[model samples]
Target: MFVSRLLAMCFLCVLAAGGTVAWKQRNVTIDDKHGDEVTGIAPKYLPSHAWSSGPRDGLNAKPNASLAYNGTWHDSTHWVNNDQIIVNFGFTGVSVYVYCIIANTPPGPFFDAFANYHILLDGVFVGEYRHDVEMIPDYFYNVPVYVNTTMQNEFHNLSLVANSTERAVLLLFDYATYTVVEEDPVVASTSTDTAAPTSCSLLPTTDQPTGNSQTQIEVIVQVGAALGILAFFVLVGAVIFHLNKKSRTPVLPGTTLRHISRVPRHLATFYRKIVRSLTSHPGESGGVVGDKSSVAQVRSQNKD
Candidate 1:
């Protein structure tokens, strides 16, 4: 039994060591030029009355070498004092990154040039960033302003807000990119016999479980089943060992057999001897003695 338990523990350890599954990853980019046109993920700007309708010309507007995602971006006219751009997107991956542009500035020690911004995910504040003039000298296009790598793989609400309104700090929102974990396609089993087709709804898949959650569930079920099987085998082994040991044991004797062996044994015999006058006594129909004592008396009488 002890050996069986040890074997079971080793088996469980092996399963735990090799239970991990490798998942693939990819990146999905959403450009700011077509924000409103996109389905289900349009960026909604707070206080809609303060923004412009089209991209207006600005100082050194174009990137150095077509660096912006898809050669398009939203200028600083889109957002101003305390304005927030909110987006609700679905992902099945690890990280999310926010990109923007910094327009060219004149030679001066203006404190407004150093802008401050805040990022929030799922209505919780994650972090913030400040644009420094010494670090970023000239007009920098398509740069990462805010990045968050610690988000669960699910549908989330992201908010990008301007924290500083000093002299209307320039904020060029270009695009955003999120890391996506691509799942391997499941191969369908085919049969020769024909079957009826199934129906599926053409609705959004935001409510469905992602690959990460599904994989985790599968692993849990598999481990539970394995443990159950191990327990069953261990119980069976213990029962068999008990039965074998009982069969090989010796049984003790009872009191009735001992009493029968203790009973005594006696001997029986016949004597045919007579004295000198016994011949005549025989003719007179002599009676025989009933026990050994009479025989002894007769012998004594003959002797007298």
Candidate 2:
């Protein structure tokens, strides 16, 4: 029984370690990331005009694409139909919301500038820009003159498509801006744990009194478990010690002289007195103490 109980305790310890490891793995998740535009990409980007680079055409985000050489910007410098304004936005595969800015020279027709172009996300047509034409060429306001992709989830390469087939009708790259949308961790991350609350996990580690109380309770349980293990080990040790002591004693079985010889030395005198009294006559002795069978047996065994 002692050996079995010891083995069971060792098994429980192994199970405990395994359970801890599993718990750590279950609740762990990579954090969600959120931020703005080309900052997330490497090398930022440089404008790669599909047709030809007009002098002073710098591709950059926001007010950065603020100016071009002549009269701020003129007459289709980066023609949407003929040119692919390659904005090498750094990273890919994550969700992001992109806003494309289209600008025109002062006095240019506010609505006419948006008449003939569409935008592509990695080569697929998401929508057209002329849908929301801004009506003021007032120099600084780069309005969403096209598809306002407020929540387009993912994109790597942004391309602009135009309506003109043979002749390059005008439209320019006003610079595009994108912001990373914080996305929840992948579904696979949440599958193993169903977000259940367990009492054992309520151990507090901070300033809240409730948490502290829970932590105290957990500590007590751990201490109690430790003490129980110690007690079990002590009990098993005592049993083994008793069995060993019994094996070492030279006591023989049933009615043997060795059994009588093995009696404690302190009891030997008393035993001798009893034997002498039994053998003596009842008149000479103080009394006859044993039953008849016992007396007969003792006399027979005396070999006298």
Estimate TM-scores for all models: 0.45, 0.31
Compute the lDDT of residue 143 as modeled in candidate 1.
Answer: 72
After superposing candidate 1, which stretches have Cα over 4 Å from the reference? 1-22, 36-40, 52-55, 58-65, 77-92, 104-113, 134-137, 165-167, 186-304
| Model 1 lDDT per residue over 123-201, tens place | 8888886766554456676678778787777766677766464544545567777876756543222333543222232
State each model's CA lDDT, in order.
Answer: 0.56, 0.43
Native-vs-model 1 lDDT?
0.56
Best candidate, TM-score-wise? Answer: 1
lDDT of 1 at 145: 77
lDDT of 2 by residue, 8-112 (tens): 656755554344322111111111121233343322222432322222444221123335322132123234344433333323333333333354332232223
Candidate 2 structure, TM-score to reference: 0.31
